[model samples]
Target: KGCTWRTVSVDKIVTRDCHSKVFGDIVQATQPPACLDACGSQKTNTSSSCWVDCFYKAAAGPDSGKPGGKVAGMSFAELTAAWEHPFLPEDQGGCPPVKPKPPWFAHTTSVEQKM
Candidate 1:
């Protein structure tokens, strides 16, 4: 059971990473490449809502400067769905609720120590 749970967690991480990479690629192709780094730096700006928000604005915002309201062959709605899919509620056909760590859990550097 524990192994299965761990596998699900790993799968979620991999899926999130893949989605992020795809979003970043589309942002890079449509906007200035340096803008990607700018989004990273904007982490301090609470209003910006992190790199994802910045990238989303750049790729799909009204002033995005892309013709035909598309990025990398995906419509704005399609792109948003793809980028935000992993975070949607499970009943809405998204990932399950993340399991919280147990109170007794702790990392051990040596096998001699109890977990």
Candidate 2:
């Protein structure tokens, strides 16, 4: 009753070769390889020193290191607007207000993960 749920991110998974030993009968996946969207590159790009150490500091091309300031010459107001997009009114592009559901529910589903 007191089980803890943990999310496994696909980024950390390194795909292993499937053999007959591991799988009894392996059938070709119904969907195309591209459509499967299976995890590929898990490389994490470092942007920690992206602004300070790069030519951006000199040419100032990447001037503002803050988020949403990617455009070469975006004003602070523009940056702020970009950052606060999620908080906009529902009439705008913001997410619709969420209605809380009751604790009691008749329908239920189970999630099973096989490694």
lDDT of 1 by residue, 81-100 (tens): 66666556656545554555
The residue ranges of model 2 lying beyond 4 angstroms of the native Cα positions read 1-71, 98-115
Please report, in order, the local distance difference test score of every candidate based on alpha carbons.
Answer: 0.54, 0.32
Candidate RMSDs in order: 12.2, 19.2
**How high a TM-score does candidate 2 get?**
0.25
Pairs of residues clashing in candidate 2: none
State the lDDT of candidate 2 residue by residue for 1-115, as single tens digits. Answer: 8989785632222112222111111111211334122323311111334312332322222444557555354345644554344345546544334444454633544454322
Error of 2 at 104 (Å): 21
Error of 1 at 44 (Å): 13
